[model samples]
Target: MDRVRRAARRAMFAEKPAWQRWSLRVLMTLAWPVGAVTETLYYLSVLPPDEIPRRALAWADRGGDMLALAFSRNVPPREYYTYRLHQPDRRAWITACLYAPESYPLLSWLNRRNGADNNTVQDKSRFADLCRRHELPCIATLAVFRDGSQLWPATPFIPALPLLWVKDLSGSRGAGAARWRLDAGHYHNGDKQMTFSPEALARQWLPRDCLVQPCLDNHPALAALSDGTLVDFRVVTGIHRDGWVEVVATLGHLPCGGPSGRRYIVGAIDRNNHCLISPTLSGFQIIKNHPDTGAEITAQPVPFWPAALELVVNAHKKVPEFSRFVFLGWDVAITPEGPLLIETNSGWGAFNHQRGIGAPLGWTCFPDIVAEYLDFSEHGDAACD
Candidate 1:
């Protein structure tokens, strides 16, 4: 519901007159202080009393330097951006404050800025629009794409593309991605075809603001007609003080569950080390075939590991603002001879499957790569490379 609501807001906002929407935005920005005050009162009830100031200071530091207005000072008034969340470590900094410091959300750019297609693409509305504008095969993503058992409706903007990619906005263990083939009759499964009219597919199953991707048709391109499972690449990168990027690890995946026209995905993480975790099975274990249908499982290790490397190097220049931040992870998709961004992430999880799949063992031998490209290092190319 949340994801859908947000997308609806984006559609409405996008259609509104520029000055009218901007004016409303300005009004909302001004009213944020009221919400912050209520938040502070809630914290006051929880804290001991003495640690409030100390806790607020810690968040003030982390909510991004050059503090937001209403809190920019030597003492730093409790700004809404950095002082509201009262994060895990933030609450600890204060001796008695009940609140974990909140993040100051003074800057709207972080929430609105655009990024590559393959990185953790969360702005379902923004990115979908970009793909439509550029005529690229992409997916429309929503931040809260789905919640538990409910899926948001499809807010597709383009009919020109035949492929639509839907991703659950909440997570990535390959948990949220789904592929949809919009053709005349209905969705095509591995061996079976379940037919549904276009009307029902939109009103009934599809999630709100999904990245409706045009299927990577391998027919004309590959010379042989094979409807193989599409694959995506992940390249985690970070910026060094010197501003050069390094590549951490590129993990490739082939779907296991097979696109059911709507829900469910079964895929394996191909960690470059000769290890391929079967998407048919969960975790590090590999399954040879689909559990229900017994279809044989197969995969193709990325033959052009070096070309995948070049794409990562080029990303830093492509997104100048994304250069900051301590971490960024992306699932890069292959197109023709190069790569197209599938999604980007600020909080890419540290999963064992990922390391086993092909991550650097301990950053000792691969220090330079992880720092700039993988976005894992506190130190960028400055120290390692």
Candidate 2:
């Protein structure tokens, strides 16, 4: 089935004419409404029987308002509850579906501009190389594994680090990411153990292509918020036509319970004041303390907040390919020394912004910024060098 889908996609691009390819892309974008409806129904299906009517009514009201808005495209059910779209002024919130590159012709064009591509941001290996070339502070890959073989180090095992993170080269949202602790001269991840050899590790946790990097430790001030898992900040940066870069939104992901639990409490950080506010669990329930440790969520401002923002903004400027993107979502870790770039997402979602701010991005300057990029993509000769 996978091979058939791959071949069909290849033929769609290679056999079809440019016009047909674009028409298909447009058709896919137009099909988003169907997905939205399906998603809405699926969300309702999971709710208790008595709660469905109220939630369904809320969806209808909000879905109608979203359809009525000029900027609103698809009404994501998750965002509806996350942002409390049932309340007034829900039209300004943009759904995650719009972030899909093929959702708009101009977005796709922006992605393909100036030989710039999402690979430089999406692929973990490529992103690390870009950071290395630019001398940016980013998590370094100690070794890489591909096709059941070690691609780096030429050794059977990577030099043991106290902790290591193995993640899919092109994965996102912590999907297919794992943390291994070096214990008793063997790498352990849960009940599974490996002999430090790539082949041995692959048998346990590798996913065809993965990067092994030394796990970063959280800054001491922020350590109490999590159970040893590195909590990172999601900083959204936008680049202007004039070569200026600014942070559009900021949020912190605090891993609650523990690293093994794989749950996070996301909080919105005020980009202007650099203070944490609106801590939420699963994007809906507002909370004031960590569920596992009972630590105050906003007891103190984020440590080295200004420096973290500066690092991401500077790092974004260093990568010219990112200039073509509408906005880059930077996962930055605040270590005791300073901030380090974990990874970047050219196609970052809007859920964190909407959920954290408790309002729609449409209510802010984001739509205008997006419009500026769309106009540039339509008229600009080339992406920034």
Candidate 3:
């Protein structure tokens, strides 16, 4: 069945946008070597034992002791997570996802949920049920498994521009993701359709060990970075008991799309179904030619800032399932309609760029807020536990 579809895709893509068709072909061809190499290095253990840990420690030493040890540097591919207890017996090596009695790993890593903000998404499991009671739609995210043994393959859409993604399902990294198309998956019919609809999306649902998620479009708003691009926002929000949710920081990203698009296009980033921001270009802009396209990063204000915040503030009341945390980061898209959710990540980063970008224009207490969340007052001298 899959064999017949592969043959059909060849015929379908034979006559489409040259850039679109050729780009997908080039991408598929290009990824082969990368996949081969990752298989090589990953199998070969390219990462040194202390490589990630040392980087974390170095970052801590340089950035002051606030978040020093909380962001455990090394995350084992499968097992082995660095564990620090609430009392601090130094860092302990435990299995990943092994939170239990007296373990503070879950909360410790919560502060880093957003790359540029110290916040965490409220767990929606409880909130999902609440939404059910209220007759609201809530989508649950399923993890894409290690083996492609899904009962359903996501019906992906091939975009004219380019889509951004992070693979591995553990963490988001620039090197971790690349553009993928229908060519990557197996299918029933000649599966090279331009866009996969809801029926197709479910038909590919492998629902085994893979992650099953609601279509991001179901959120209030949804749009590709530029008709086809997946470049999106990683926006942070803070909620006060006073019922106002504020956009503390936003990490507008343009993934490795053409170096040109990277320079000019800033996509959406969301914290949850609640809030997100679009690149209205804010204060400054990057004035470089894209390595791929040759466009320049133009400056504009953050789009729908006011409306986005209102959604976040009212999110708990709206979703009710995500009311666990007062703060969180969302990868959002601000469409012609409104703000929408991309997905929710538990461990997010707090800085936009690792090095450059100078100081932020607005308040800089995101880390401070994270420190407060970590119960810094009680820990006293405990490292990032």
User: Residue by residue across 90-181, what tens digits does model 2's lDDT show?
Assistant: 53434422322322333334455434576778788888888888888888788877776677767655356777887888878876788877
**Can you give the lDDT of residue 287 in candidate 2?**
85
Candidate 1 vs 3: which has more TM-score: 1
TM-scores of all candidate predictions against the true structure = 0.45, 0.77, 0.42
Worst 10 residues of 2 by lDDT: 1-10
Write down the TM-score for model 1. Answer: 0.45
The true-versus-predicted C-alpha distance at residue 326 of model 1, in Å, is 2.5
Error of 2 at 47 (Å): 6.8
lDDT of each: 0.41, 0.66, 0.37
Clashes of 1: 47
lDDT accuracy of residue 288 in candidate 2: 90
Q: State the lDDT of candidate 3 residue by residue for 1-385, as single tens digits.
A: 1121122223323344777876776775566444443433352243334433356655334233212222232122211211112213422322112212111233334423322222223333333334445544334333343344542225442222122222333344432333333334422222233344334543443332223332233122222223234445565565444434555555665434442334333333343532223332321332343234433433233456556555544553355334444455666555545555554443344323211122221223333333343333332432231
Candidate 1, residues 216-255, lDDT tens digits: the string is 5321232111225655556666455576666544444444
Q: How far is candidate 1 from the true structure (C-alpha RMSD, Å)?
A: 15.0
- Runs of candidate 3 with Cα error greater than 4 angstroms are 1-204, 207-227, 240-244, 256-293, 300-305, 316-321, 353-357, 360-363, 367-385
Best prediction by lDDT: 2
Rank by lDDT, highest first.
2, 1, 3
Candidate 1 positional error at 379, Å = 18
